[model samples]
Target: MTRSLGFGVLLALQFLTRLPVPVQCPWNADTSRWAVRCYPLVGLLLGGILALTGRLLEGWLPTPMLALLLLSLWVALTGGLHLDGLMDVADALGSNASLERRWAIMKDPHVGSFGIIALVFLLVWKGTLLLALLESGVSLAVLVAVLALGRFGAVALLVLSPAARPEGMAWAWKQHLGHRDLLLALWPLPLCFWLLPGGMVLFAALVPFLLLYGLAMIRAFKGINGDIVGAAIEGGELWLLLVAWIWWSSAMG
Candidate 1:
């Protein structure tokens, strides 16, 4: 049981980040499915790293430059995986094409103009929000909480969402994710309350919005896939950062 859970964490790190998960574990559908349960763990670890970076560089660099550097580190850590999904989803949605055509566009190796613009806007928005939060004296813990919850959102989507295709990583994950797995995933929920300022209330409000967002993505794509899941994770992270800043600003005022 211990080994299984350890592999789950390993698989999650391997899948979600560019980190070298040096130890090889038994690879199978079961492990792949179980790995989703640890997605938030990976997010928390990533958040911790970012939080440390913020703390170490506090007052050492200009706000804008610090935010930019953190954003770059974020992209580098995740290998731009979710950002790629965000861009693909944007391009597909922008095409105004049929579902089949949209899917093809997402699968295409080349990025479109819409993808480029969307990526730019997302990065800029996140950087600006980070700058605002740092300037407002918000703790790095808030950022960590946001990152953790963002990945938790992804795991929730996986458990709740139907698969768009019978093949590929999404389907493989879906096949293994059960109600029990979902329960296991929720173990990290307490981290939100411990890490954020108004986390409980904000989390309560965020639930419906996340549900609605998931529904919209499913409606737009006809079903959820790996790309949609990634997009949701990225969107949720940015949304939390924005919400945190607003909450912090109002509180300070």
Candidate 2:
């Protein structure tokens, strides 16, 4: 069981980030199930790296520059995989076309004008939030908490929601996942609460956000897909940061 779980973590690291795992985990139902369960753990590892980077750079750089660097590192870590999904969803939604047409738009390799605009807006807003958090002397644990929660929400959405299509990676992944897997992923929830100040309140707020966001995506896309899941991770992380920043600012003031 331990070995299987380790392989699962490796599978998740390989899929979710650009990190080199250096070993091939045989892909099958058990490993895939473990992979889904390990999503939040992978996110926690990412958060740890980002938190360490922020701590090391806190003294040397200006807030704005530090925020930019952190944001760049965030993208570099994920290879902008979620960002691409965010852009694709933006283009599809902006087209305001039929459902089928929107799906087709998302499948297109070329990004549209809407995608570019959304990307700019997302990055700018994220940078601004990061700057605010840094300026206010926010705890590094908040960053770790937010990232873990964001990925946990993504995992929840994947298992709970219906797929937008009957095929593709999302659908195939879902085949190996169930409510039990979601329960296993719940390990991160308590850790997130322990990691943040007033964590209970923050987590309470996050539950509704995830629910509403998941519902909105389901409505907009007709169901969940890889792109939808990607958008959720990006959107959830940003929202978590925004909430944490606001809470920190209010508490400090």
**What value does the lDDT take at residue 136 in candidate 1?**
93
What's the TM-score of every candidate structure? 0.96, 0.96
What's the TM for model 2?
A: 0.96
> Which residue pairs come into collision in candidate 1?
none
RMSD to truth, every model: 1.3, 1.2
Q: Flag regions of model 1 displaced more than 4 Å.
A: none
lDDT of 2: 0.87
RMSD of 1: 1.3
Cα lDDT for residue 195, candidate 1: 72
Q: Candidate 2: worst 10 consecutive residues by lDDT?
A: 196-205
Measured by lDDT, the strongest candidate is 2
